[model samples]
Target chain A: MSEVLVIVPVYNEAASVLRSTLEGLRPLNHDILLVDDGSSDPVPELVSDLATTVVRHTLNLGQGAALQTGMEYARREGYRFAVHFDADGQHPPEAVDALLDEMQRGEADVVFGSRFIRADNRALIPSFRRGILILGKVFNGLSTGVWMTDAHIGLRAMNRRAIQCINLRENRMAYATELLWQLRHHGLSWKEIPVAVVYTAYSRRKGQSSWNALRIATDILLRLIYR
Target chain B: MTPIQLLLFAALGAIALIYLKLVRYQLGAVVLLGLVLLTGCIAVYAPDLTTLVANRLGVERGTDLLLYTTVIFLCGIFAVVYGRFRKIEEEHTVLFREISLLQEQVRRGGAAT
Candidate 1:
């Protein structure tokens, strides 16, 4: 069992960016789980020989389900640390190591990578995106009572306990907030890291619309009502 | 209660039951069945009750109240079906991913390594 397993949930990502992203993780050489979320593209074929295991979804379930699949696979395969990375080239591959190191220090059960956590990364993030993240922060605070600087960032590393406790139900973008709620509800220890993301034009194109904050909020509200 | 109203209630309830069953969405079937019964009762014995409730709720007419309630009820049912479908999809994804991992291992000569 590897000490750390990286879970990258990808769907129909461009070949060029994925190749670069996979290559970027070569230095850490962590066991990679690339969850192909029912991609139309030949994602599995492209990553077949990338020193990684490809988990295929027959139907497109969405990023949350893909991440859950990857996390469950990591848990089953006996990984001490499991990381959540985006398929798009937004997240920094090496920051995964930083998150795992923080987990190993025994300070936190879960580590979240936040671009707003550091001054330099904050400076790099554009104003338009920061406003959306702040809206997410406010929503998280009001809905889940979990206050954070950034809420939508996918960069995360969790240990076995966190994996066992933080069960995600949301199948899409809303799962990010659901993960935060679960962590807060379970009273699990968590730390934040100042990780920077590339935010390339392609990644930006793939990003969720800021208006989607309404849909995410409604999903959370309904879950709360139905619960 | 008119014979016409009773027939309409029965017909609509039957349609709802059939439609729900056809879809095989059973999560809230019992609740839906209960709603049907309540709707039957309203149609048969207390159709004017809608008017009273509408007055209390500051709505204009009995039909308007029924329409509002029906829309809200449908939305609730929609939410339930949506949630159930999501749960089923997640479970399938989990199973699918597990099988993929197994197949991959076997392809690589598996535990024999």
Candidate 2:
């Protein structure tokens, strides 16, 4: 078994996009687990021949729930490390190697992929998203008490302890903040490494909107009250 | 004795019955629902008493007081439902995760370890 498991959380993504993503990671030889978040499409049959494990939600849970399912699978299956790779084809497959390399160093239990750490990466992000992310950084810092250069980046990697300790309660966009909060609460060591994000028109269209930030903030507040 | 009062009392009685059945195991909920039912009976028969109470509470009118309380009650219900909805969502997620994991194990022809 490969030491690292790549956990891809896919929703209603097109078959073509998912194919490209799986194809990119095929050469890496890492075990891949795709948590299909109750897609109405024929995702299972479409990727039936791929050498990856698919755990499917019978109902539509959000991305956070999907990732949590992946983590649980990894913990049970005895993977030493897990990478959160998007099936939307925005995350770089090569970055998986970067993340695993950093994770194996034993310095940090979790490594976050940051698109703003380098100049070229910073330029690639659309300005509106940049503004939202800056605001999100401050918002997350105030709420989660952990701050980083990026907020809500889909690409992240973590080791076994981090995987075992992190339990995500927020089932939607708010999980990004909740993950940071868990990092602090669990006292898991973390570092941010620059990774390239390819913002194709497809990803840009499918990505979070500026208005959704407000909804995410509201979710965090509600969790505080209800929890 | 009036038409509206008669209608309200009938409605309140039905609601009280349902509440009693639903919350029989929850002592606190039973007490709260009983108080609400008592208030509903008083408001149905003696509307002026609420106006007097509303005056003591510094509200101008009993109808306005009822409106405010109704709004507050709805907001409380909304919060409770939201919290419970989140809990139910979590439970569903667990069920889905377990089913998916078990299904995978079954497909692999290996018993879950």
Best by lDDT: 2
What is residue B66's positional error in candidate 2, in angstroms?
Answer: 1.7
lDDT per residue for candidate 2 within B17-76, as digits (tens), equals 887887775889888987999898999999999999999999999999999999999999
Q: The CA-based lDDT of model 1 is what?
A: 0.81
Q: Which residues of candidate 1, in runs, are more than 4 Å off?
A: B1-76, B109-113
Which regions of candidate 2 are displaced past 4 Å? B110-113
| TM-scores, one per candidate | 0.82, 0.95
- The most accurate candidate by TM-score is 2
Q: Residue A116's C-alpha lDDT in candidate 1?
A: 89
lDDT tens digits, residues A71-178, model 2? Answer: 999999999999999998998899999988988889899999999899999999889888988999999989878889886998899999998999988889899888
What are the C-alpha RMSDs, in order, of all predicted structures? 4.2, 2.0
- Candidate 1: RMSD over Cα atoms? 4.2
What are the TM values for chain B, all candidates?
0.67, 0.91
